[model samples]
Target: MSEHNTHIEEHRDDEASKLGMWLFIFTELLLFGGLFLVYSIFRLQYPANFHESSLELSVTIGVINTIALLFSSMTIAFAVTAVQKKNNKLALRMIGITLLMALVFLVNKYFEWGHKFEHGLYPGSDLMQLLERGHHLYFSLYFFMTGLHALHIIVGMILLIIVYFKVKNGSIHHEKYVFMENGALYWHLVDLIWIFLFPLLYLIS
Candidate 1:
């Protein structure tokens, strides 16, 4: 092989990698899109139930979590920018802050779920047995969708942690920061999903 061909083989395409991440993100959107469609149909079937069920949800906590996730999304974006600017320390700090925000989100979710359980609102509970079909379905969907989103948040947090250490070790730097970009993209998707979820589950009226 020619020396030029060998050199080209050694370097990867960052734009191509980003395109791959975008494609993956689309698949995720489609998956959630189906769930949202189902939720909409059910709401139409039981308009009053959905509205009342949404009222049971703590709007104050939901709004707080929304703000936290949105802020974390910005932090991760800034971290990626710092990497592009060759400021690895700032990138690490940004990632740290983003991770803390994720922790806060999870803590809030724990308490929120706990409160529901205390009220016997979880799936298959005695209270669930007493509720009408529409009311029962509301709590069921609420648990299923939010549970999946929290799982995504956990995955995003793990990705951010890995990227933070990689940046600290100089593996992800200005000229080669595609991994950081991918991590940021995933985090943004997590936040975006929650943006849709908050209103769907909390403000249905």
Candidate 2:
């Protein structure tokens, strides 16, 4: 029957959408995995150097950024929940809050990075000055890894902005919130990366 054909087509469309999202997520994981592998190899090769370089990082600033990212993740989660409840206003508010938190996180990172640059600790430039003293390799990886992560955070914020508008304009609804959900998932991935990065780059002995 034509009715049965229509139902089947709709189901296929839904399944395809979900599959696409999962594929995107998997690719993101692999991208980050490559960076993690590099970090692990370098850390293993220069444990002492890494530890010493890590000490130069501002623990307080890192902690604050961590808290900001965690709060943003929470806000995004709430936004997703609000959309599920069909409360567009609350969802928009939550997304706005998440965006604010993301901005705060980026600002803190800017200062942290600026402080390092002031000390001539930038990657590939004055890195030799620190490595010459024995253990600046860690700083190299720190900047490379954390710098890449910060870029991802910026990307996540942009995605959130898009999702906010989509939800606000009623393009996303309770029954059709796949885009918003996927966007939240991506944002959470960014936060999760920072969670691991904080400990690896700043907390490890």
TM-score, one value per model: 0.94, 0.88
Residue 146, candidate 1: how far off, in angstroms? 0.8
Q: Write the per-residue lDDT of candidate 2 for residues 1-205, one digit (tens) a residue.
A: 5655654433426566767877987897888788888878877877777777778878899899999999999999999999999999999999999999989998998999898788776876655564653366666667777888889888898999999999988989898888888889889988888888899888897
- Per-residue error at 185 for model 2, in Å? 0.8
Candidate with top lDDT is 1
- Tell me which residue pairs clash in candidate 2: 49-135
Q: Stretches of candidate 2 above 4 Å error?
A: 1-12, 127-130
Q: Evaluate model 2: give its lDDT.
A: 0.84
Model number with the top TM-score: 1
* Per-candidate alpha-carbon RMSD to the true structure: 2.6, 3.4
Q: Which stretches of candidate 1 lie over 4 Å from their true place?
A: 1-9
